[model samples]
Target: MNTPTSTHCLDWSSKPSFKPRILALAIATAFASELMAAQDSTTADKTNVQDDLVIYGGTYRNTATKTALSAEETPQGYSVIDQEELTMRNADSVATALRYSTGVNTELRGGAVTRLDLFTIRGFINYQNSYDGLQLLFNDWNLQPQIDAKALEQVEVFKGPTSTLYGSMPPGGMVNLISKKPQQDATHSIELATGSHSKKEASFDSTGQIGDSDVSYRVIGLAREQDSQADTAGDKRTLIAPSIDWQVSDKTLINFNLYYQDDPEMGIYSTLPAAGMFRDNPNGRFDQNSFSGDKNWNAYEREVTLLGYKVNHQFNDNWTLLHNARYMDATAYQENTYTSYLDTDMRTLHRRAYLTNETSETITIDNQLSGVIQTGAIEHNLLLGMDYQKLTSDIRYEDNAIAALDLFKRNNSLVDRNTLDMTDTIYSSDFTKKFEQTGVYLQDQMKIDQLVLIAGVRYDDYKGSESGKKYGVSTDTELTEEHVSGRIGALYQLDSGFAPFVSYAESYQPETGVTRNNEEFEPSTGKQWEAGVKYSAQDGRLSGSLVAYQITKDNVPTRDPNGSPYDLIQAGEVESKGIELELNAQISNNLMLSAFYSRQDVEVTKDNNGLQGKTPVWTPEQTLSIWANYDIYTGTLAGTTLGYGIRHIGKAQMDAMNTDTVPSATLMDLSVGYDLAGLSTAASGASVRLSVNNLFDKESYSCYDSNNCWFGAERTVEASLKYDF
Candidate 1:
């Protein structure tokens, strides 16, 4: 066995202006002679489309060919949102970036300082988050995009009951964030942006070699402050992240990452009843004082560290082995207020602080052997591998109280006293919890003629423990479960540009709560089957895909009459079927367009609460997104670009009864930018961009659960500047 050394970084910065200038002059000199032909706009359109640049699949390579081929590919639906799309959309936070993604929902709470966003994928809610393939240990809401969009290479969304590979989670997808690694060569850039809602932000990123021996490092930092269109609410955030990569030897590489973030509590702006009814009030005003008392004082502080090591060795040209291992630790604290119709006039002050510690390490050893067996008639690529992962998490919580008046009218100018009421009204619970999980997987890939096939299977074991007080009584419980999951699929390419594929996969999620009768429920299992067709141009410039999928989950836990509020064991069975279509093409060198459309039917097939026919609360039936950008110049004026986009979300039911619902809504945005050369004191290239959001000033709701609801932002405008050297 031998290890592989670090490879040089990839670069994409190149510009040639002379050729465009010469072509421009020639066209201008022949303008009169070609006037008659030019008069026909159709002729110009044909010429322009031929000159456009097509980005078939953006910058990331599709190397998961083996994983994507299977009769049952572990039956899960996953999607990758790349850096190019994130940058083009100017997403400021993780929640905003995933807004239009299929089967994903976001919930925003509190003011800027105490803002909490949650994502539910395919009827599953995820409170635990991960970064760089490692779990981020925090229970309270944490904003991720604050870390700097420029620092992330891509965000992978793995959907439909994925606890077999992970340890514990809601019945949703997992979002794996991939961070930018240190580049072999030096590169630097700076960005300054000002946008609607009085928002201002500045960020910088740089990478280069650290020392003489093949050691490289990268650092990214960002600071942002914005006032909300709503009164008395906004957010301010600061983040710093740095990473280093060292090539210890030909077959060994080590990487380290450190990150820190600070955010203060801001006021919470929420909708209020027109006069007395919660759901009946449609055009209700935002109760700026909804969280007035001590609850209004919310804030979050977080820190995380990650260390990783990778080793690869080529036993020979026909066989190889690869291994990767990582460790991570993180923590966070938050406080807010809650109010109910029972005490509508008085806010019930509640304080919550959660601390989590997690560590995970994975090792995979794979051998790939290939040879031509029957001359040009038979070829094989065989793969054999073993995979292992161990993860543990410890969580603690604290609850406190403040006077109703103090919670409804909090003053951020000063810190309020920590008054302890010790009375029956004051409630507090302390808990220390731990969870462990392990998984081993094996996979194989084979090719014959023009057909490709892939297969894989994994076995997972999970255990959890909770030790704390329940209703003033000491409580301790332990739970365990195991599952075997796998996937298989095949792909066939036709002579033209068409390729059809089919796959089947199985997934599992660990159960977190017991049944009303005190019996621990087994892990929930999900099975998925899918088929799709893809088309692409010969040059790989234009491509499109149409896919249909169905998923079913069984063995869900039911609610307990005496269960805690946080206990979310499944109540019954759920089934979902959906279709998605995506298209990407470069109409011309100066113009490009991308679009996606999805429709899903999610229902609870079996439940204890008579909720079988109800629609999932946050699962929108339809979602659509489109974006197009055009460059105004080809050479010296090439920096000018104009862009516009729109997102539409279909109506969604809010409650199990399905009587109350949030209607479908559409939002539009526009942007324009110009690049200036040799005008910056610190760099040679500078650009300024202006954007308008919700151009129609639509007043609509973005999300609503039974107990809480959020309104989308109104009309807002912002401008930004960037300098590169």
Candidate 2:
């Protein structure tokens, strides 16, 4: 076992010379702009400032980028879900809010039992989720928390490999959650909601300036408890987040935030036998709400605390500096029993119970300097950034055999969850994993009148170590890796609000697997080439993008079933080619529309065991979603609004071997809202809305293979009442 030695630790600590050089370069670059600013006394800036609605209603412009290029000018595939859209859909989790995103798929691992949000972007699974442009870590092996979307101003999905700006990520893409910031004008809202499955929820949010002291505060809190559609399963959550902004001086500002979460006691559901679901069955399909696992016996509890801060300073009108950091501590314990596999008879199911405990801590910091300058006839938007991320985790996994159940005679009360004891559980494995990554990136978005050129490059250093007792044997290993990634693109704008662009991006993802020859597998690399056209109405009421792209990943790791366990092969390659179209428009004073269409073909281009040319699991060939809302403008129904949404998912294969395929599914959602003030003067600031999901009660399922499957959501009706003061 090659454990990370003390010498390696020394090597990790020996890379600080780059920092001072970067700082010095940033300073020199900012000074280089002095003559340009002095030369051009009058330059009409077509850019948005800090306080502007960088993300105004359905606007493609975003402040999250460290540069001045909006979505249209960035020359990459992107999607944004504003607060108004999420609120209208009544989205509760990050996954729910992003289901309509092009080429995206979300999964709930253990069904209603473990309602954590997991996702696959494009054709690859990703674990990198960002909050307020910073990393958010909530992982316990396969278990992760479902981020609350209620406190977010918007969610941005960057398609393709984004490692040039964001550090070490899955080849697919990333999700960026933008937190709601403190506002200058007073804003406050209180809401109460209830829905099917005996759900009850309440939330409060308020933001405004503080007593004219050049300070502002925003606080958001929510509590919810609900019964799961799965039998005997229930989940509860409580969260509080308080943030503050202090304008220390005219050119500098400080921001701080604290978040606390107490989420415990959620069930984790896996699945039933394929005999009843996919293949010929001795018995019929199990009851949709039947209890396969004892909800009380299975416990998934978690708690998390996060502290973060940011500082921004403007040295001059052309340059600004920003520093942001965050630290998180998360702990969780889980014990659950799931069907191990199907029995020979196919009518009875066997079970296995597992117990695990996890504790993880992470720290991330990013420092950036962004500026705008001009040289002759060219305008440059430049950003330089350095980031560091570190994480350490400890986990314990154990297993035990559990009694089986007769599929034909299933009832919640049949299993006495209270009598189950963990005392007899056998310890199986314990391990600790630690990871560190540091990156320095720079991007320049240059504009020459109607033409914009975007380019970026990044260098990354990574090290990972794992130590544990496996199979009653002690083992430890370490891997050190480094790589460079970049993106380049150009966008040409026409006089009629149309933009045509072409872009290329690449990524490097390190792996821990070693080959039979004891040689570590090389990092997987991803490359993409894309071309698109964008349109933005001058009034900012309409935006759209039509993009065509091709992406390929190489050096993917795989195991040959016909070979030894240690025979790991790195000769795997996969490719995804797709087209995406997105549109958001406010056609008239009362009508709003949002729609998207994505068609993808993901296949293994190179592999062993006849796996070549096969479709991987969870890659849907087509996905389409559309939503429209219209508000009554006058007369008797002046205060009323109606909304309708439709979603379609194309067929998908179950595994790399293509043994089975899950059929496509479609769903519909409806919403209605009315302002109470129009009905009576006493309720001036009160309003009510009702939303129904899966309006037709469709039976949809997501399958990973023949043995593993997930049932989709059932019909649900929820109503919310809100008051603004």
Q: Which candidate is the best by TM-score?
A: 2
Clashes by residue pair, model 2 = 110-269, 113-267, 113-268, 114-267, 114-268
TM per candidate: 0.78, 0.89
Candidate 2's residue-wise lDDT over 590-691, tens digit each? 999989999989888997567788887777889999999999979988788898999897878854478777778899999999999888989988999999
lDDT by residue for model 1 (64-112), tens: 3222232222223556678866766666666666754656665433122
**Model 2, CA-based lDDT:** 0.72
lDDT of each: 0.52, 0.72
Q: Point to the candidate with the largest lDDT.
A: 2
Q: Candidate 1 — worst ten consecutive residues by lDDT sum?
A: 1-10
> How many Å off is the CA of 218 in candidate 2?
0.7
